[model samples]
Target: MSTLIVPKLDEQPWPTLGPQIAAFIEERAIFGPGSLKGQPARLDADKKAALYRLYEVYPQGHPLQGRRRFKRGSISWRKGLAKTEFMAWVAFAELHPEGPVRCDGFDAHGRPVGRPVNDPYIPMLAVTAEQVEELAYGALSVMCAEGPDAEFFDVSLERIIRLDEYGRADGKAVPLSNNPGARDGARTTFQCFDEPHRLYLPRAKSAHETMVANLEKRVLEDPWGLYVGTAGELGQESIAEGIHEEALAIDRGEIDDPQLFHFHREAGGTYDMSQREQVIEAVREATGPVGEYGPGQFESIAKQWERPSADKAMLERLWLNRWVRSGQQAFDPNAWANNGLPGSIPDGALVTAGFDGARYRDSTAIVITEVSSGRQELWALWERPADVDEWELPLDELRESMAYLFEVMDVWRLYCDPFFLEETVAAWQGRWPKKVYEWRTNVASTVVHAVRAYREAIASGEVHWSQGDPQAADLARHIGAAGRRRTNFVDDDGQPMFMLQKIHPDRKFDAAMAGLLSWEARRDAISSGVTRSRSSKMLVF
Candidate 1:
């Protein structure tokens, strides 16, 4: 409400079952896992409006008509809001026999109708066991154990089983602190996390992602996930923050993620926390009716801000719901996004190319840059398919792509990693001579300066790509995943040196590595006075 920093989805055109889902929640779920323990649940105006967007479905004539729009989403708000209680409402709807959650078909009026996910598997995950008991799992258990729907479910402290007609368990909502894969291969239809901001541990992250990977198994169920949390601590690289970055990219229009819905609301502008009125007003905007500033409310959350040891940054993150940047990221996602210059390098353009190859367990990529303008494009990338076990780089097709590039354009240089591409690089060098040179990243002694210069190029917009290009998303993802690694070394410029490495071990950045090498090749082309004319030779290794 306070000038929504990241706005919610539009309110009009209730072309979704979101409203129906909201109705189902208000009628079925209860108000408290906290203060109003046995009260009938009432979703406030703000909370009710969110369901409309979150439950949008694809319309007729669309590729997957009548299917729900979002496959995953995040809702970020200030502290003290009943986010876990809201998630519990959704969890009930996900598994309740009569709850309208999955899109069934169109109504006569052309709007989407909904049905419950069949045999739904819902996992409520948290960072620790105490947190598991303290959050959404707790809220859900209270709802099932104490609410009107209590007879429909067999509830326990850790699990809720929806009873079938014969009084047997038909669906389950389980609480897990580790990977759900270990349980029953994780057929996660609709999973919820209380606060991914606190889930920075490697084990928790890995576990949650396993459930995500398992979402595809129940494709007919229209599987999805809802993560509700606030801003994360800086430098932690929390899951919420990662999704927050993805949300920002979606907002910027630099990338498209059609199946993701992220709602981030925070009060805008700075405030003097010492001014009681100003602080209360900001809190009021963030909390709305839940602000508790009125008389007889008894419990005031604002006292925490006045504590002597209160950290202003922590206060801004938790209370104001502001995003804080991490220092470990090698490139700023915003800057990289802004550099979407819009157009691919044309045929017959003078170019410098970089090739980074891996035989297996990673991606092999080639990126090319137009020398005259520094515009870059992903030429090709070979990645291992998950379903394929006996996979390797398609050398035959790779050679065809390489040969065709030289056939169509004036390639100034190809700085290639000769690791798995040793035979290919040798053949390329034999044919192109001075045009091909080996760039081994592991030899940090020489390539560190080149790496530093390429980083500078991206920062200053010396290199850019078209947002409209099909490869922009891949490039953006690789760029975002890249992190600065300490080299315990220095470059020729007498500054500390670093290398770009994957922030998550599970993520790959071969395309970004190829782009860096491409820019470095262009730098040396300029230094050696290489021209577009074929009469001159490039820098030889």
Candidate 2:
């Protein structure tokens, strides 16, 4: 009989560090800290059951360990697993000494491989949910091991999953919910926040507070470290942006490093319109070999996911280390330059005032208007500088101007279209005795009315401006360029109310504010209020 030859276990070829990390395992996958040998595993039946209820699967990993790890061992692969199964595996992996590895995703063909490989693979271990479970498992895993010193506790946000949940985790989350308002149960040694830039303006405060709390709690154990998200809005208070700036300062030798890990999206240059074409061309060149659609295709592949335009811009900044502008105009400045009117009003014409209040660096201007020969004439303008107190402006000048118009022109009532300006209106009333005043509470609604009035007046040939007053013409152009559209807003009843929302936050013409004020001051006539005793002494006037 021929002797059966079995290769010695020690006779196996030892792969180099690169290939060993990149080695394909047909069934069991080894990741991170490498081979799982004698790592203590604590199978918690209660925590396992709770996770089972959440994910709907058995809590314990099958055969515990060393029954060669399965090909689907990494966090991402298990995430793609049945939810309950994935949860059970994450719970088990968290408590197990080796911190989660994957067997799927081929080195070249994208085929399933059992052993971990290291060919520029995406780090799936840092997935938000997986990180949370990993955090929860850390202490337990350490406890189950011989002593605390044997296991390292990673409190990084990359390992904490609970922050992503909305509301307290009473296991009420619907499957696949992406709620940001959820409570975090991940308590570990230290924590690192991920993607803070994705947070909305409204949620910024609460999210920041949570990070601070976690940092404080962990600091008691050691000089605990907290790493916030690294890419986001340009605001001073933006969490990601703030952290990234700090990291950049460290890199530039402007600051000392506390040994913090910074994964920054470098914005190499200013994001101006001038650089837009260059960016596009760069993307094209980078993807030229693939085809016209190659740029987008390459980016999608690089990101390993489909992303929205806003997110795409952010990702490009982060990973490719590219610079990109936010790329939308607040208002079109050209619209003002092309459409503005060009001088002083003719004598003995009807007049009105356009006044706007100042709040910031933007100055407020008041324009005097008159109607003459089928045209509106701008006679004069009074402007408030940004540096001075708006309330301290010369009221006597305004009064004198109105009084002069009343004497020389067919002056209309000086309209004060807003009732909310009680102080300003009262002041004006004190200055111009017997002058007319009009007011409305809802400025937005009144704006709608004024827009309609302007449309009608223009159609009827009742609107005109001075031929030489470029500022007045520019103001007109700004007003004319203001577009209108319905937008969804929440009413008092918590129901959706469709109203006219401004298209441009930066570029809106305060036409409504101006028109309402003008209309209130300059309307033609008013009928008296109804009264039964019309001939009484008080009513006879």
Those runs of model 1 whose alpha carbons end farther than 4 Å from true positions after fitting are 1-20, 28-30, 33-40, 44-82, 92-123, 141-176, 179-192, 196-227, 230-325, 340-346, 386-389, 466-470, 491-495, 531-541
lDDT of each: 0.77, 0.34
Candidate 2 residue-wise lDDT, 385-445, digit = tens: 3224443445566457656665665544455543334566677778666554644424555
Worst 10 residues of 2 by lDDT: 71-80
lDDT at residue 2 of model 1 (Cα atoms): 46
Off by over 4 Å in 2: 1-198, 206-338, 343-350, 355-411, 418-435, 441-447, 455-512, 519-541
- Lowest summed lDDT window (length 10), candidate 1: 1-10
Best by TM-score: 1
lDDT of 1 by residue, 1-541 (tens): 2433233355555378878888888888887566688888888766776677788787877888888778887888887677877888888888798899888888788978888778888988898777887788888888888888888899887688999888998899988886645754877789887899988888888887787887788898989999998878645768887787666656656455456777777765456678766776666666655556357232244566678887766776787776653455677665677687766787887899999868866788889988878888888888764335677888899999999999887898899988977988999999999889998988877666777777788788778886557877778767766777778787556777888776755456888889888988988777777646443333333
What's the C-alpha lDDT at position 312 in model 2? 58
Give RMSD (Å) of candidate 2 vs. truth: 21.3
